[model samples]
Structures are given as C-alpha cells and as structure tokens.
Target: MRIASLRQGAAVISEAGAHLLPMPVGDLVTLGLDRALEVGATALASEPVPYAEEDLLLPYRPASVRDFVTFESHVEGVRRSVDNASGVPAAWYDAPTFYFTNPHALYGPGAPIPRPASSRALDFELEVGVVLGAGGTSLTEREAGAAIFGYTIVNDWSARDLQSREMQVGLGPAKGKDFATSLGPWIVTADELPSLDLDCRVSVNGSLVGQDRLSHMNWTFAQMIAYASRDSVVVAGDLLASGTTGGGGCLAELWGRSGQQTPPPLEPGDVVTMEVEGIGSLTASVAVG
Candidate 1:
C-alpha cells in the first residue's frame, strides 16, 4: 500500500483515490510496519479524497537521516572531477559509508527549496530512500532488510563550493548540505516494490538532466542498514538514502564528466523533479534562502 501525509492527516492511496488515516503517518509508523499496514488497510474503508498533488506534505518527519554512497560509478565520476587520475577510494569498497544529515531540513512535494545564501554552486542528487519501521543495534543484513517499512524519492541538495572546501579539512559536507532535502510524493510499502531494479530520472525546469537505475548501486539497502547498525541503533522513522546514481544523477557528477560546469548552477525560480519508477515524482522549486 502507498501512504502519504497531507495537511489533513496520513492517507492511503489507492486506484479509487486517497483515503485518510485516523492518525498522522509518524504515529502510524511507531505502531511498527505490520500494524501500520493494517491501519492503512483499514483506512481504505473511509470516503476517498481526490488525490491533489499540491496538498501533500513530507510523508512523515524523519527521525534521523543517514545518506550512503553505494554507487561506484557515481564515486568514480565525482573523484575524477576533482582529480584527473582519481578513482573510488580503496576504503570505500571495504564498507558502506554514510553521513548524518539534518532531519529537520526536509521539504515535501511542491515545496520551495531554499538555496543557501553562501552557495553559488548548488546541485541536486537523485536517489531512493527507505524508511525503517523497526529499530535495532548490531543488526544482521537479513534483520535490517526486514526492518524496512517503505521507499520514497530523495533529492539530496548540495552546495558544491562549500562541500569541497569543508571536506578538504577532513570533516564535512555540513553547512553545504544542511540547508535542504526534498522527500516525498509518498511512500510505497516494501511488499509493493518487488524489485530494486527501478528506473530513476531527474529534470531541471522541465528539461531532462539525469537518468540512472536503482540497480546501479554497488551495495544494497540491506547492507547499508546493517552497516549503520553496527553497535549503534536505528529506530522507526529513520531514513536511509541510496546515494546519487551514476550517469548524471547530480550536476557535480555532470561537471566531473565534462571537466567543467556545463549548465549553470541552480538559481531562484528553478523547478526540479526527481522520479523513481514504483514510488513517484518529487518536485521542488528553488528559491533564495
């Protein structure tokens, strides 16, 4: 089942339309994935509301956000953009690495993303994210896989100039990325997604910019989750993102490919739309912060 958060409340989307849930999505998720699915199913009996895209909100506020770089091609492309002879770091192949991001900075479908005032080189990363329904510490891959509740599209916005400088000091991507992150359209339950091999695409101001497949990731979501849970806890509502896809998932990767910025960086009034095959499209307009 597909669940969406609206100004009214949580909703279950069906062919007929969207049905409102009795409680908010964040609360439903706390009931655990199975019980949440049950609640969603029960909500289907309520009168349906027209599926108005503009009325949607972040599917649910994330408990915490952890983004991982699991795409080898993306890593290689980005590295080459920085240093001609560079390739994926040898350490990168040893484990699934991720960074924590601000969960409060999230925006939903149709929201306007604020470009940080300090950035002139803004970019977007197209990715797929999974929301967890169960929590655990030192989880096994199979256990982590079972904890997944559903999936959604994630637009991990970036400030290239800032990210570059901070990472050089060996510590960040912090201020560069803390400004904004767009998520939603809605979340499709794990059972609803039979395969991870889905097409992913992104566009800027109605012009196609990048395209790739979810299957391109070298490491699976389960592996990323298990790695994250190593002696630490990941709880319900936590979000984990599959880093940018290769084949032009982000402007940085594009610049890396061409050895220079081709299309200019995002400016005010730009519209970005990111889509994943089974989930849906997530669009956000760019605005000066």
Candidate 2:
C-alpha cells in the first residue's frame, strides 16, 4: 500500500483515493513495516478523499539521511569531467560509498527549492530512495533488505559549482548539498516493490533531459544499507538514497560528456520533474533563495 503524509494527517492511498489515517505517518514507521501495513490496510476502510498532490508533505521527517553512489556510469562520468580519471577507483568497487547529508533540508512535492545564493551551477539528481522500518547495527544484506519500509523518488539537488570547490578540501559536499533535497508524493511500501529494476527519468521545464534504469546500479540498496549499518546504528525513519543514475542523470554527466556546459545550470523558476516507475513523480520549482 502507498502511505502519504498529508497536510491533514497521515494517509493510505489506494486506487480509489487517499484515506486519512488516525496517526501521523511517522507513527507508522515506529510501528515497523508489518504493523504499519496492517494499520494501513485498516485505514483504507475510511472514506476516500482526492489525492491532491499539493496536500502532500515529506512522508516523514527522516531521523538521518545517507546517500550512496551506486551507479558506476555516473561515477565514471563525473570523475572524467572533474578528475580526468580513466575509470572508477578500485576502492569504489569494494563497497558502496556514501555521505551523510542534511536531514533538515528536505522538501516535499510541488515545493519550491531554493538555489543556494553562492551557487551559479545548480543541478538535479534523479534517484530512488528508501525509508527504513526497522533499526539494526551491523546488519547483514538479508537483514538490511528486510528493514526497508518503502520507496520514493529523490531529487538530491546539487550546487555543482559549490560542490566542486568544497570537495577540493578533501571532505564535504556539505554546503554544496545541504541547501536542498526533495522527497515525496508518497512512499510505496517494500512489499509492493518486489523488483528494483525500474525506469527513472528527469525532465526540466517540460523537456525530457535525462533517463536511466534503476537496474543499472552497481550496488543494491541492500548493500548500501549493510555498508551503512556497519558498526553504526540505523533506525526506522532513516532515509537512504540510491545516488544519481547514469545515462544523463545530472548535468555534470552531460558536461563530462561534452567537456563544456552545454545546457546552462538551473535558473530561478525552472521546474524539475523526476519519476521512477512504480513509485511516482516528484517535481520542484527552482527559486532564488
């Protein structure tokens, strides 16, 4: 079942429409996946209301956010552009790599994303995100996979110019990325998504610019979770993102391919729409901060 956090409250979405839940969506996460599914099924008996996209909110305020770079093509593309490297580093192939991002910077569907004041090159990353329904430390892949509660579209909005400068210091994509990130429409529970292979696409101002399949990832969400949980505690409501896809996931890849900024960076008022099959679309408008 699809669960959404609406302005009114938590909701269970069905083919007919959205049904209000007696509790907030965050409460459902605390209940764990099995119990949450049970509660969601019961909530579906309530009167259905139109699923107004604008009424949505972040499915829940994440306890923390970890974004993993699992797409080799994306890594290769950006590395060539930024470092002029021949290919991915050997260490990258050994394990899933990620960075902790600001959990407080989240926005929901239809929200306006502010372009960082210091940034001149703002870009959108098309990705798939999962919410954990159970907590564990040093989890195995199987255990980690079972911890997944649901999936959603993620836009890891980037200030490319600022990111480049910060990475030169040997740490951080901090201020470069901490400004904004988008998640929502809603979350489709793990049971509903038995397969991870899905088509992912992004469009800007109504023009289709990039597309990739979720199957292209070099690492699975399970691996990402396991890697993240190693000697660390990961709890319910934590957000994990499968980083930018290849085959045009972001403009940096485009620049890498062409060796110049072909399409200019995002400008105020530019609308970005990212969609992942089975989950849904998440669109955000760029605004001057």
Candidate 3:
C-alpha cells in the first residue's frame, strides 16, 4: 500500500481510495508501530481526508537522515570528477560510514529548492532508501527486515561553496548540506516492489541528466541496515539516505567541461524530476527571489 504524509495530514492507499491516516506520517510510523506489530497483520488501514497532491505539504520531518556513502557509481563519479583522486579509498569498503542531518531540513516535492545567493553553486543529489520501523537496538537482520515499512526518495540539496569551505576545517559538510533536503509524495511498503533492482533517473528542465540502476550501489540496503544496526537501534521513523547515483548529480562534480554545464546555474524556472523505477517520480522547481 502507498502511504503519503501531507500538509492536510497523513494518509494511506487502500482498495477504497486514498484514505487519511489517523496521525501524522512520522507519528504514525513512530507512534502506532507497536500496535501494528502486535496485530501481526499485513497493514494498518485508516480513513483519510481529501487533499490535493499539489496543495498537500509532504511526508518528511524524518527523525534524522543518516546518509551513507554506498553507491559505487556516485563514489566513482566523485573520484573521477569532483574529488582530486582516482577511486574510493581502501577504508571505504571496510564498513559503512554515515553523516546525520537534522529532520527540520525537510522540504517537499513541487516546492522550491532555494539556490542561496550566498553562493553561486547549488545542486541536487538524487537518492532513495528504506524507512526504518519501530524497534530497538540489537535486532538481527531478519528482525530489521521485518521492521522495514517501505521506501521513499530524497533530493539532498547542497551548497557547494559552503561544503567545500567546511570540509577545509576537517569536520565536514556541517551547515552546508544541512540547509535543505526534500522527500515525499509517499512511502510504499516493501511488498510492493518486485525487487530492489529499481531503475532510477534524474532530469532537469525535461533534459535527462542522471540515469542508472540501483543494482549499481556499492552497498545494498540490507547490508547498510545490518551494518548500521551493529549496536544502535534503527527506530520506527528513522531514515537512511542511499546517497546519490551517477552523472550530474551535483555541481561539485560537474565543475568543468565534458559538454555538461549548467550555466546561469539553476534559475527559478528550472524543474528537476527524479524517477525511481519501482516507486514513482518526484519533481521540484528552483525558486528565485
């Protein structure tokens, strides 16, 4: 079933139609988790309020967006273009590493992703991930799998100049990547997907920019969750971002020539759409002053 969190409020899709959920998406995911688990049923159904998709806010407000460097294509793309290197360092394969982002940074699809005047470079990072369900630490992979509710997309908007400046201090990305991140239309249960081999892509102003398969990820979701939960709890509404994929994901990589240059940078009129094969598409337009 497809579940959406919007300004009008939480909702889920059923045979009847789009139904309003009893509570907020985060609250529903974090709150009633134990109740749903206790029942041991396929899903929790509810009556939903009518809200226009465009007018609706969105399901973000994640407890946190724990980002991990797992997609190899993204890694390679960085190395070959942005990073002053050739490939991922030897230690990258040692284990999963992540950086946490505040939940308040959440934005919604169709909403304007601001391009700060403070810096001329602003960009998008196309990503997707598993939504962790209610649970505590020490849960085994089998248990983690059971706790998983579904998946959603993220546009990890970045301030390139700020990120580079902060990285110079060695603490890394601090307020740079914290400015904004968007997620929505909704979250779908894992049962809906035939396989995780979802084909995903990104387009700007209707022009294709990034396209690749999830099969290319250096690390899979199961491994990411297992490694992440080594000792900590993967809570009900906690989110994990599967980083970005390849080709033109961010301006940090597409700095020079290669026949790809976003001059005038990203103006207010620009529209970017991200598509994940199994899921659907999310489009966001750049807003100007």
For 1-289, candidate 1 gives per-residue lDDT tens digits of 8899987678998989899999888888777789988898789988998867888999899899999998888888777653443677899999989999999899989998888888889899999999999989999999999999999999999988888777776775788898999999898999999799999999998999999999989898999999999999999999999999988899888888778887678888988999899998999989744
TM-scores of the candidates in the order shown: 0.97, 0.97, 0.86
For model 2, the stretches where C-alpha displacement exceeds 4 angstroms are 83-86
For 1-289, candidate 3 gives per-residue lDDT tens digits of 5677666656675545456655566766664344533322333444444566585466646666788877765666554433345667788888767788867868876888777668656778888867877566766667767677678888888776666566666665776688788886677767787588888888889988778777777877767777777877677778887888766565445553242444325667788899998677788988867
lDDT of 2 by residue, 1-289 (tens): 8899987788998889889998888888878899998898888988888867878898888899999999988998877665555678899999988999998889999889998888888999998998999989999999999899999889999988888877788785788889888999898999998988899999999999899999998888888999899999999999999999998899888888888876778999999999899998899999754
Model 2: pairs clashing at backbone N, Cα or C within 3 Å: none
RMSD of each: 1.4, 1.2, 3.2
- lDDT per model vs. reference: 0.88, 0.88, 0.70
* Position 112, candidate 1: lDDT: 89
